[model samples]
Target: MGLKSSQIKQLERLYRRKIAPKSVISSQLVKDLCTAAFELGRIVGLLVNRRGSVENVILGDATRLYLPDIGRIRASSQRLRGLRLIVAKPKKKQRLKAKSNMVFRPSLYEIDHDFIVDLEKLRLDLVLQIQAHVEAESKKASLAIIADKGTKVEYFRDVNNISFDFSQFIAELEAKITSQIKKAHKIALIKGERGAAILIGVYLKTQKAWKYSLNELKELCVAAKVTVVDTEVQRRLKLDAKTVVGQGKLEDICLSALHKGAQTIIFDCDLSPSQLNSITDLTDLKVLDRTMLILDIFAKRAVSRAGKLQVELAQLKYSLPRLAKKQTGLSRLTGGIGGQGPGETKLEVDRRRAKDKVAKIEGEIETLKRQRRLRSSKRHEKKIPTIAIVGYTNAGKSTLLNALTNSKVLAKNELFATLDPTARRLRFPKEHEVILTDTVGFIRDLPKGLINAFRATLEELKDADLLLHVVDATDQQYVKHSKIVEDLLGDLKLLEQKRVIALNKCDLVDSEIAHKKAKMLGGTCISAKSRSGFKDLMAMCSQALWPKDIFR
Candidate 1:
């Protein structure tokens, strides 16, 4: 890494040299750059803007060079970065073969894959590599530019022979990229949705699990009304410590997202604070994990005051520890009820204020919980059995309640469609009346903050006499879905409670298969949408609630 004063001065002088706007590089400039690299025994690189003025003079070891932080490409813009990179690499005489005419092949100077990564990731105007030789007559260079899907590279036998107008070449390349992006995003524009995202999943588990997780992420994105422009999945032995997905895959994802006009990156797995920080730093894009996306959906779906308070509490608790100095994501949560305090630094102030808000919200939620407890006592006094319907999200629990009571409770075929619990009184065929309650749906790996914040609402489940587990009959992953609900119930210590599994959506599958599935799981088959199995479902519920009583 040692540099002589003469070498340092020569490299510094490069920053003062101006290139011709119409040509890639002048013959004299190329000769001087090659001479500097040959003397320093290292690679010399330059960052040149479209005006043909040198912006930076970079020094690197033989193989790799690191660029300074140039800000991100604006997501709204569909053009190149308007800057190009030129590098001079000195080669040993043994690595270069001597031809009959004493000239080496231009392929020796072909662009490296690392440079290709830079070309796509930075959206550079172009990248040029010169194979610096002691004999100036034998120097060769290669040029690369952005193509439709990847990069296009060309080689020149002589670095000094390039005569094309660099400015005009860059203009046409940007126009092509802009036109393709417009065509690709036309449908999203027509739909008038603003947030466009790319979904990322890194899995070491079974492929089925991976696919299911990614599909669930997609549904979450849909529930949030984000336009999914693309999805990238990596099958790895284990998650990368820093990026979750490896750095290479993440770079490819950024390039794809950049080309597809996506402004956000949504991961299928929950991210630790360090992973989130590392990922956001690498791409400079809005980064969100499964938990953040779920919390956001809860924020949007919450209607009741209690529900809203619970959602805000969950968001704050999840965001407090993750508040970094450079954090730009999760602004909605960090901003809090009152805006930033005057004269207080951001990171420390956000954590302090969020803790205060969490305490206030917790107190409010506890008050609501006490009120709910009083109501539960009244039901207990009347000797009315309570049945709480719980299942994986979008498993038709709300629809089943609507079908049984003929009351609408905002039933939609989306995840977490019913955030606030709804209760209705329904009479069995035997005229035995019971209070049926619908609670928030469950999912695998539910965020811990969500579980703690919604504990008040879920407390009612502990008092219920029977747990009606609704299973989506049509899903190929129904067994796994049932297991997830059971696992959650076990975590809540409600598994010991009497339970009745009703396989909902039976009409969407074959009747024989549905019946077999119900029999296998020791449950009843029913269609919440059609109400076809209402009688059997009621019989099962009545038998579970009043086993000693005889029913007609």
Candidate 2:
């Protein structure tokens, strides 16, 4: 079709006002004109005066244009400034509606009026159809441009052709977007209530064992008010002596921590001083092994002065060895048997301070131990029976104590929730009364430093008339936990004492199953939350503590 008189006038105005003034037409303006013309269902060409001798033509829809005589021609729009616009006619007439539906309705209206209405409807429909076709072709071209990877590829005429793999570009863009999202998520988590930590474990055991241990570590972290974002576990026949994990695994762990925005790395097992240093140095993140994590929980949970002293003493003892190990120069100082001339380094000074702090805390603990003994002696004079509640961490010991004495203690589901020992009086039948004390919970690999430092508090156990070993019946590792507590009791030399086991958390398990487990472990099933089966537990305690008495 030919251009209308009005369209030609508009084009002349555009050229005079926007195009003719510039010596060279901008590539953007060329692209705009081409896109507009193509949308209007017209193919256009730019005829430019090149060097005033020959005319050069630049066509829209570059893929349809061919130049057989030119070898590997490159298209450029920089020199096409004083160009005349050329519009090509459509190859075929576009149909507005299906021909089968068209019919002459002579009886409906006057002939001229009906013909005009039908022709206008057809014209409107034709424009809509052309717009739809243009949109479909545009989408197809975009997809082709994105998917093309061959050595020779055609690009849009107005845009620069940059040789690159579209697939690789899209992949890299997606990765960058995903990384930004993760970083924002991590920042939100950090700026919220809790800090983030990554848990790492190296185990020679089965996956089940690793899961169990790592879960406990996670609980410990929770109790300390730290969020564990991720965990990494490696299974090997032997653990790496320096970093606990192999070098490659350590690097992976570091990268994972960085990606997760974790500020700390927690190990499942205790690390030696040298191992801790090596891992921290490599990761550049604060590293804490299982023992130190437990100590941190205790430090946060301890409320009483005595409890705080015990925790500090343990921490100082643990740090002393690390401090000594940090001073590699100390070995040089001890070169000869009689050579003692070198002065103290900063590490030595820190070690000395740590030792002094340990001594002060130990002396305070001894004084407290003495005071505890005197109190115990006074209770013994009154002939009052005493019962101690002991169990694994988070096994509901504090809940059991609260249930028995009707006193509220900090009973939480997290490990090491209650660090300070709590004591309450429980009155039995016939005015018989016994003092029940709740001690710190035990774990599988309880730190030796903790045990030694808490001796002042644990000394209360030695004078007990009977031991109430509380066991968590609902724990999947209940049996292992029971063994751990029993082993610890044996180490404390309280195994020979009169003991009664109260299978706690029976509310979480089937009654029959709990009863069976209690029987197998020689315990009485009870639920602290529901206060079920406590009468039997109390009767068993009475028999064990005051056998042959009328109260029993």
> Could you say which candidate leads in TM-score?
1
Residue 459, model 1: lDDT of 84
lDDT of 1 by residue, 401-424 (tens): 999999988999899999999999
For model 2, what is the error of residue 118's alpha carbon versus the real structure, in angstroms, after optimal superposition?
72
Worst 10 residues of 1 by lDDT: 327-336
Candidate 2: clashing pairs of residues = none
Off by over 4 Å in 1: 1-13, 72-77, 95-108, 134-138, 192-194, 325-345, 381-384
Clashing pairs for predicted structure model 1, backbone only: none
Provide the TM-score for each candidate, comma-separated. Answer: 0.88, 0.66
Error of 2 at 381 (Å): 1.5
In candidate 2, position 204 carries an lDDT of: 91
Candidate 2 wrongly placed segments (more than 4 Å): 1-194, 324-342, 550-552
